[model samples]
Target: MKKSLLMLNAILLLTAVSCKKSTEGGNTGIIKTDSSTTIVTDKNGKVDSLSESSTIVDVNGKKYEKTDFVYKATDGTLVKVIFKNDPKESTVAITSNKKTFTLPKVESKGGETVYKKDDMTARVKGDSLHLEQGNNIIELKRTKI
Candidate 1:
C-alpha cells in the first residue's frame, strides 16, 4: 500500500510540474509554413502565407468571419473596404496594407473577380486567403466564422 501511494504521489507531482511548465511557455502569435510569403502578426491573430493561403483571427486567436479570399493589386493601388449594402451602396474604409486584406462584405463580388493589369491577384481557398502583387504576397488565415 505504501509503495502504491508513493508511486501515485510521484505521478501527480510530475504531471503538475509538466502542466505548469507547458502553460508558462511563451505566447507567440499565429504561424505560417511558407516563411517567404506568409506573415503572422505579433499578437498571433493574423497571418499571411503569401503562397496562396492566409489566415485572420481576433485578439483571442479566433478567426474572422467570411471565407478566405485573395486579391491582387498593382503597387500604389489603394484598397478601400466597401460594404455591399445592396447593389448600389458600398462604403470604403482605408486599412493598413498588410498584404492580406480583410473583407467586410462576406458575399460581395462587385460583378468582377479579377482586376486586369493591376499586378495583383486575389485567391481564396477554404479558410485561407492570399493576395499577390508583383513580388509582394499576403496571406490571411480565417479561424472563426
Candidate 2:
C-alpha cells in the first residue's frame, strides 16, 4: 500500500510540474528566413509585411539588385513578387497559386510600373498590384515591403 501511494504521489508531482504555466510572453514582432526575407507579424499572429533585399551575381561577375514584396488578395490569397534589376535588363517574377511567372519590364512612369509576358500583364502602383490574364483579373494589396 505504501509503495502504491508513493508511486501515485510521484506521478501527480510530475504531472503538476509538466503542466505549470509559463511566465514568458508571446512571440516578438519579426521573423527572418534563410533566404534573407524578413516577415513582420503582430502580437495576434497576423502578418504585417515581408521584404527581401539582396544582391545577385551573374556568370559574368555582374551584380544585380533584387527585391521582393508580398501582397494579399481580398480573399486572403497571397502573392509574392520579385524584381531583379541590372544595367542591361530588368525582370519581375510573380508567384501565385504555386505558379511563378516571369515578365520583362515594359514601362515605368509616374510611380507606376508595368510588366508583360505574352497576354498576361502586371501593374504596380503605390501599395496595390493588378494582374490580368485574358479576361480574368486579380488585385492584391501590399502586405509587406
Candidate 3:
C-alpha cells in the first residue's frame, strides 16, 4: 500500500507539471498534495484549492468527500473530475488541446477502474487517482469547484 501511494504521489507531480507547461510555456513547476487539500493550477494559470468544508479525501484511512473540479482546459475544453469516498472511485472526463480522455472500459488493477492509453495510464480509487504517462506519473486527489 505504501508503494502504491508513492506511485500515486509521483503521478500527481507529473500532472501538476503537465498543467503548468500547458499554460505557462513550459517554464514553471509547482507540486502540492497532502492529507488535507489538493492545490492545482487552474485553466487561467492560477493556483487554487477547494474549500475544506466542500472537498474531502481519505488520508491515514479517513474518508474525504469532495466535489468535482469544473474548469476550462488550456485548449478551452470543459473538464471535471468527481471524487468519491467509500469504495474509492472517481469520474473523470477531460479534453486538453483538442485531446479527449475518458474512462476506459477495463480495470487494470484488480477492481480499480482504469483510464489509459499507449503511454498514459490512470488508476482510480475512490477520491484518489494515479495517472502515468511514459516516465511521468501524477496523483490527483480532492476536487476544486
Scored by TM-score, the top model is 2
Candidate 1 lDDT by residue in tens digits, 2-120: 55445544764797588442334555444212223234333345653422233332334443321122222343232322212224322222233433333332332633233222465
Task: Supply the TM-score for candidate 2.
Answer: 0.61
Question: Relative to the true structure, how large is the alpha-carbon lDDT of every model?
Answer: 0.37, 0.70, 0.50
**Candidate 1, superposed: residue stretches over 4 Å from native:** 1-85, 88-94, 97-117
Across residues 1-145, which tens digit of lDDT does each residue of candidate 3 receive? 4554455446557986875434446432332223365454444667645422334544555564554444433333333454344345544454333355654434546547776656778786544566678897666654443
Candidate 2 error regions (>4 Å): 1-50, 56-59
RMSD of each: 19.1, 17.2, 16.7
Q: Model 3 reaches what TM-score against the true structure?
A: 0.35
lDDT of 3: 0.50
TM-score for each predicted model, relative to the true structure: 0.26, 0.61, 0.35
The candidate that achieves the highest lDDT relative to the unseen native structure: 2
Lowest lDDT sum, 10 consecutive residues, model 1, at 77-86
- Candidate 3, pairs of clashing residues: 11-137, 11-138, 11-139, 12-138, 12-139, 56-64, 57-64, 88-125, 88-126, 89-126
Q: What alpha-carbon RMSD in Å does predicted model 3 have with respect to the real structure? A: 16.7
Give the clashing pairs for model 2: 49-144, 50-144
- Rank all candidate structures by their lDDT, best first, as comma-separated numbers: 2, 3, 1
